[model samples]
Target: MTSLQVKDLDSGYGRIQILSGVSLEAKAGAVTCVFGPNGCGKSTLLRAIAGAVDTWSGSVRLGDQDLTGLPSHRVLQHGVTLMPQGGGVFPGLSTKENLLMGVYLLHDRAQRRHAVEQQLENFPRLRERLSTKAGQLSGGEQMMLSIARSLMLNPKFILFDEPSAGLSPKLVSEALQRVSTLAKQGVGVLMVEQNIQQALQVADYIHILANGTNRFSGTPAEIPSQKDFMQLYLGVKDSFNQDKELHHG
Candidate 1:
């Protein structure tokens, strides 16, 4: 029943204000998606939550924990993992090496071994490529490796910044399906996505942002297709026209 909460958040680069009063909640066992056009501070929101970016105002809470103002490493230690954009696996590192990197915080050798074994069990595909350079793996496999690496900490909540970027259409579907599966496994997921079509498929709850502020928060089906920005950023153009025709009929 734990949840990640952001309330009355405000942050920006230097004097340039990006996010203003943004707020939302992402609960365990569910997928909460944030969709917005470019430069809307979606990535900044994730960075702030991960403590990668400093927050000028507001707080980030995980259940009872106050995570705001902590450093990035500290946030990860608290079970909030940020999977930044770009296939995050180290290109020159072997698959096993990348996984080992994930457990750098662990002091116990046995514990690190156990974590690696558990992730291999969770992502069997990686086990088969243990000796291969991470860069040599296919894009899909690279993504899996990144997820496995993030899971080495056994995070309660994983923040994804555009997980589907640079993926093929088919891989996008598969990747998003994997994201949904993670939620079902009881991990809270906060995704900042640009692919409206794929995002709509997996989002249990959705938040729309415009100019770095929350514009809407509801279930996917509750989205207002008629809204001008909905059609533009949401890629749901003219669906409202059909709904309007039905209403007239």
Candidate 2:
């Protein structure tokens, strides 16, 4: 099965350590959500998997290939892509132009054209604003463009860093739905998100990271049973109780 696996990973910036012995697996046809409070090294973990940060020790493997230590471009060629937070798009470029940049690795003109067409189909909203500058789009639209750009490559696994950040409640729901659809389409999705309720709704499995290491990992169904876990690691009252109050009140 296609999967992204990280084993005992330790990585950080120069002289400072952020992630320590962190490990998780993102499987094909499943959405894995990483939850953490601020500064818990969630983004750092994704960056380490994307090969944007240095790994002091550990292995990142996709299927049978060892991806550790490879540069970002090399990692992309291996069917892994990272859609960073804050809608990483060239503001001055048109929506179509920004998507075309995603398939730069495709040398053949016909193939590149086909990739863009497929993305346009997947994101019909972008088709209407194909010529609009990315900066001119709304926050939700920009997020769609960022995700559509990544989909242009048709990667086997996607590392999304806070896809719902800064979006309105309506847009957040839509964004999470799109992510869930990607996993159904057989793309392994590893997302770091602070939207706890939304993340639980769509995630097949959840991993809670604290102090740069995994503190809890379980299926969504199991989360409600762990009240102390929710209180201690997540720093919240019982999630189940909260849900119950919201429903009954």
Candidate 3:
């Protein structure tokens, strides 16, 4: 089982940098989570690893393979996949059709069919919605479909961006549970999620970002308390806000 590793990564859009010497490790059979204030570059870290964003410096590695600077498709070819924000499902496609599309790269008809059937077995909730359009499914259902589809490629690692974003609290719990299940099944999961408590419960390792760099990294139990984290990050934000207000005044 290979682990996804990012070492001193620096990347951003255009001339602006969102990550600065950021590094972390996501291991197979574990869920590694990135938590940060908005604009702190949690998503950029995942994008950088997947080669969806350019790495201005540093390295991305999966075992001995150097993945730095590889294009997104090439990254996928190497057994790493990403589930974009909000599941990235084709709203117009049927649930089954969307799952089938996940393995479109496999030219063998039998292989593709077998892959879809395997996902159906793992995600029985999707079995009932095979004929429904993806957009018509509930938020939780769509997330399940996305997870099932990603596994079709048999990726060693998967990146998730805001898996619980649009779901209700109950749905969010269910979705996070599903993420944990993926880890139990031996898939390395790196996720960006806003549901702090839920993520803390399920994540094997937690990394918190601030100003495009890691502010904290540890197991949930290592924290003094969630309140301490809130104060640490929010306090920085509050100081910045006061300075801004003073300048405006």
Candidate 4:
């Protein structure tokens, strides 16, 4: 089943069009990574989907709900969550309090409690630092908290913008692992990522965006095979097939 869909999405800042006729879909229980160079409107598209920006024209559907032009909170009500590029957290609050705030939309106290317990099970490190102030946590811990907190709502789809930004190699691996696990648990993940290799390693499908439009989209195997796109978008000098043939022979 399709978890989220965007059609002919045209949006941008006032008087400046950043995305023109952008369209894509995130399938249920799959990881779709949108890869692109800088200034390619990657973050802009994410903002448009999350309802942080008004769409000039288009339709955003989460399941059957039309999320176009809805406020961020209302979008969340549709079971779609976005964790923007930066780690969004309350600096003054304890880690546990920050996680609790993520469940604000849940009106049932019992359900919220159950979700919190489940979250601790999913992210044990968070449980260990439950009483620590969010600001005091390391960058990786903050990133984990940011992702863990969002799970409190049990969202159907989550948008991740540069989830690997500002992290060590170990943390990057951990972040990607968590995202992969989320997809396995039936949460659709649409990620805007700069780490092409790592993203491709975990992604079920990949979309390459350039000049505010979708340049190409396919499985990871199709990416490094397209020489022109490799040189143009990702700047790969040689195709993966050539390397594979040499190693095999």
Q: Model 1 off-target regions past 4 Å?
A: 226-249
Candidate 3 lDDT tens digits, 1-249: 678888889999999989988877888899989888999998888888888999999999998999999999899889899888888999999999999888878899999989999999998989999999999998889989998998998999999999998889999999999999989989899999999888888999877778897666666666676566774455365332212211100
Which regions in candidate 3 have their CA more than 4 angstroms from the true location? 231-249
CA lDDT, every prediction?
A: 0.86, 0.86, 0.85, 0.83
Superposition-based RMSD of candidate 3 using all C-alpha atoms, in angstroms: 6.5
The collision pairs in model 1 are none
TM-score of each: 0.91, 0.91, 0.91, 0.89
Which tens-of-lDDT digit does each residue in 6-26 have in candidate 1? Answer: 988999989999999888888
lDDT of 2 by residue, 139-195 (tens): 888999999999888999999999999999999999999999999999999999988
Looking at candidate 2, the ten consecutive residues that score lowest on lDDT are 240-249
Collision pairs in model 3: none
**lDDT: worst 10-residue window of model 3:** 240-249
Q: After superposition, how far is residue 98 of candidate 4 from its true place, in Å?
A: 0.9
Q: What is the C-alpha local distance difference test score of candidate 3? A: 0.85
